[model samples]
Each structure stands twice: as C-alpha cells, then as structure tokens.
Target: MARRRRKSRGRKLILAVAALCLAAVYPLQEQLTDGGGDSRGAGNAAAEDVSAAASDVFRDGSTLEVHFLDVGQGDATLIRCGEAAMLIDAGNNSWGDDVRDYLEYQSIGDLDYVIGTHPDADHIGGLDVVMEAFDCGTVIMPDYEKDTQTYTDVTDVMEEKGYELTLPQVGMVYELGEAAFTIVAPNGEYGDNANDYSVGILLEHGENRFLLTGDAEEDSEADMLDNGIDLSADVLKAAHHGSRTANTEAFLERVNPEYVVISCGEGNSYGHPHAEVLNRLREMGIKVFRTDEEGTVVATSDGAGITFNVPPSESWQAGEPKG
Candidate 1:
C-alpha cells in the first residue's frame, strides 16, 4: 500500500507540471495565430522595439531640431541647429509664457534669430515678452507696419533691448551653424493687405529643406515663383493658418513638400485650416499634421531624412485608415 501511494503521488505531480507548461504554451500559440502574432501585447512589444531604434535624429549635437509649438490660433516655430537657435513668431500675447517655457525647456539660453514674421496681433502679440525674456541676436520682420498696440509693444521692447529690427529682403541668406536659410517673401514690394507682406523663409540643412510662410498669400508666392527661386522642400508651413486665402495649388505644386503643417486653435472662431486646404493636401497625397489635433509638432532632421515626434499608427503602417 505504501509503494502504490508513492507512485500515485508521483503521477499527480507530473500531470500538474504538464498542465502548467501547457497553460504557458497555449497563450503563446494563440498569440502567434492571431494575425501574425500582432495581439495587443505583441503590438506593444513592437512599439517598444521601434522606439529603441533611436535614430538619434533629434538628440543634441549636429542634428537639427524644429519645434512647432502649440500656440493656439497663432504660430511659433523654434529651430535649433546644434548650438545655434532661431525662433519664428511667438504666438499671441497669451502664449508668451508657454513659448518662453518651451524655449527654456529646450535649454535655449540665447536666440540667434527672433522673427516676428508679420505685425498682426496674432503673430507679434508675444514678441515683446520673448524679446524681454531672452537675449536675442537679431529681430526680423516685414517692412510693413501696423497701427495697433501689439505692434507698438514689440517695438518698445526692441528699443528697450537696443535691438535693431531688420526687414528681410528677397534672396537674402542667413547662415546659422551648419544650417542656412533664404528669405523668399516680402519680395521687394508690399501690397495693401498685411497677409501679402508676410515674410517667408526657406531653411536648408544638408539636403533637407523646410519652407515657412508666415501668413503669406498667393501674391507673395507668385513673386517667389517669378523670381525663379527653388521652391522644392521636404516640409511646408501652410500659410494664413491654413486659410483658403493662401496655399494656392500652383505654390503647392512647385513646393511639392512631402509633409505639411497647419497651426491653429481647436474650434477657433475663424474656422481655420479650411477644408479647401486640407482637400488640396489630401488630393496630392501629402501627409498633414495639425497643431489643433497633434498638439506641438516637432520635426527633426539629420540632413538626410526627417522624423516626427509622433509615430505612424499600426493601421497606417499596414496601409489601412485609422478609425
């Protein structure tokens, strides 16, 4: 009876161990069968793998960093090429703190270029605050002026800081670190409209190019075309807050950017990022990233290829629309 009980106990122990092994292997087999093992857990694992790839595209050093701050219905772009930095528009007055905080977060101690783009309240409202907060090298604005207090405030700060404002001329080039940029708009003449006088910049780092049109409308774009400037770029900052008033098809065709960025507030009163502009981009199969939807969008380039802060979704990777 003692021998029989010992054998039975050993059999039970072996069965229990086998069951545990099966339990472990079954879940793994089920996972493998589920659409090439792309279960939620597997997907998370894949995401981790991709994250670890660490292209080092945006890290400190020779890499170039461009930040599109979420200023809400306005524009603020910060570009950092190694130790050199440039700020393009600081958004409205209300965004002053946010813009400053962002610059500080990026460890920016001084600014090589502070651009106002235009004198519109939405464009220069925070210029005074930025100028007051940081040591700026040069301030760039259009030749046009506005009669509002917003304009006066920026000038006062510039005067207080003993900074001279330079009117960007067409074909003028600015070299910062390893990057270089050309002023492509406010091209020699001004129109009665403020939007037409907006300054446009084409920044080049290695082979990568970025075009930022600060509310520039079709007239200015036409001037760029007439001047026979190279308009092809990797990215285009859609003008006039993506209003139909700008981003003409001809301009888009000439630029042929792979990606387009539109900056505006969510549910803005102006109904910005008009459908027409989005339609044009979609028709051209260009990828669109919006401030309202994506929050602050940052693009980093190593002078070879560009990378974005957000990764493409799994569905987008698999050639399916994201729900």
Candidate 2:
C-alpha cells in the first residue's frame, strides 16, 4: 500500500549479484525470522555488527522480494517491497492456511495488491482464507467466471469484506512501495479456456524485472508477444508450471529470461516442467529453480540487482508424474 512516484527509467543494473541473473539479492527471511537487528541497543557488539551488515546490504531500506512458494502442484507467489506486499495466487484450497503461514512467517506488512490470476481452483482456492486473514488493497481477477464452490467461496468472502473484483486492462500499471508492476495478459477472450484468460503481470524493481503468467498457454503467450509490450524479463515464472503446451520456444525467446522458476509438486500428475520445456531452458543457458525440489524459493532484489536465496539446481531433471 506504500505508493511512490515512478522514478525516471534507465537505471537498469548490468546483471544481478545474480548470471544465475546479476542482482544483489539474498535470502533475508532467515534473518528476519530470527529476529534480525536487536533493537535493545548496541550492548552486544556482535548483534550491532550483524545489524550493521544487514543495513549496509539493504542500504536503500527497501527491497523487492518474490517468494515462489511450494504449495504442491499449485502456484502461490508473494511479492513484497518494504511495507507493501502483493500476492499473485495462493495455491489450492488445502493450502490456504499454509499460505497464511507463509505470509505470517515473513512478517509481511500490508498487502496492497492481491491478484487471482485466473479462477482455476489451484490458483484461487486459498484466496478466500487469505483475504479473510489479511487486509488488502486492490483485488484483481480476470473477468472469466467459473461454476465451482472454490470460486463461490472466494466471491462470498469478497462480498462479505466489501472487496470488489477489479478486472485488469492491458497496460495498466500499479505500484508497491518502490517497485512497479504492469498488467500484461488476458489480452482478449478465449472461450472456455480459463488459462488463456489468466491475468499476467510484469513487475519492475530497479534493474530487475520478473514476468509471471499464470498457466497461460501458447495462444495467450502469442497474444502477449504481439501486444508490442516488452516481454523481456530477468526472471520468468514458467507458465502452466512449465508444461509443454505453454512455454513455447518462441515465447521463451521473446522473454529471454536469465532465471526461470517452476512451481509444481514433487510428483505431480501433470508432470510439470516437462522434459521438452526443461531441455529448451537448458539449451538457452538459463538457470533453473523448482519449488518441487527447493521448497519455497525466494528472490530478493535490491533495486539495481536481484539474487535468489537458493542456487540453481544442478540436475537436468524433469518432474515425473506420480505413479
């Protein structure tokens, strides 16, 4: 909810402390979780030294954090910039409480923007609980509708909370603390395919940009490319959990991301991050991270640079369908 005037463009960093994208990002949650920075005074030199070090690294007092949470074959991403926090999706219904746990763990302040990329249960199933748990700013979702209880539950909560479902329009930009994000997808309608109607967003924080297109397939991807909007990003959240149907080579070429984060279960039925997609990413020399293996992966960007909490996986592996 912390808004700021858009800074003039053109201060993009060369790469993150991150080819594995080059941003000065780190896993600051562990420290924040462990009660970072003792406020009881500098009586403890060690504590003061540690706090000073953290202060030096996070010099600007604001950082853009994107956590690709592991919600078992579902998608949930938490993006935070200083006091402003935004959530893309919150995974399945069963994971709703866990999603709250995820938010609570970070001590995330206010959620300015809470988006349900599409009405798929995996994406919005947990939203009802999340909305009930936190106070959010603008809540956006695609105009697409579904005839399911999961969807109904979300709407019920929204109605009760006096929250309105704001539909996204292409080119609309919003702010979160120091970072800014633009609505990029749902360019047009696609009949009954909710995936194509997925509301995608491109987040920009300093030199780092991340593109997250929830479950968008080839048709939607093509539309995004033709929209004349820049699709290039430092980090790409592979659509449809890296399903071959989405993440086409042509689409990947346009985005040309340095790092790719694929969120799926350990042994999901869909076999996400399929061999074909993984192969293409590997060929392109882009580093890869997976929620299935890495649990909740966090990427912290200090404006000029972006870095991931965990290193890219060394294994050339694709998710296997559960037996």
lDDT of 2 at 224: 97
In candidate 1, what are the lDDT values of residues 199-218, reduced to their tens digit? 89999999999999899888
Q: What's each prediction's TM-score? A: 0.79, 0.83
lDDT of 2 by residue, 1-323 (tens): 22112221221111111112112234544433443221212223343344345434553547787878777788999988877889999888877776775576455556799999999999998888888888888999999989999999889888988898899999999988899999999899899999999999999999899999999999999999999899999999999998998999999999999899999888899888799999999999998888777556777888777766566765768888889
lDDT of each: 0.73, 0.79
Give the lDDT of residue 136 in candidate 1.
98
Q: Looking at model 1, how many pairs of residues clash?
A: 1
Best by lDDT: 2
lDDT of 2: 0.79
Which one wins on TM-score?
2
Candidate 2 TM-score to native: 0.83
Which sections of candidate 2 miss by over 4 Å? 1-60
Which run of 10 residues does model 1 get worst, by summed lDDT? 1-10
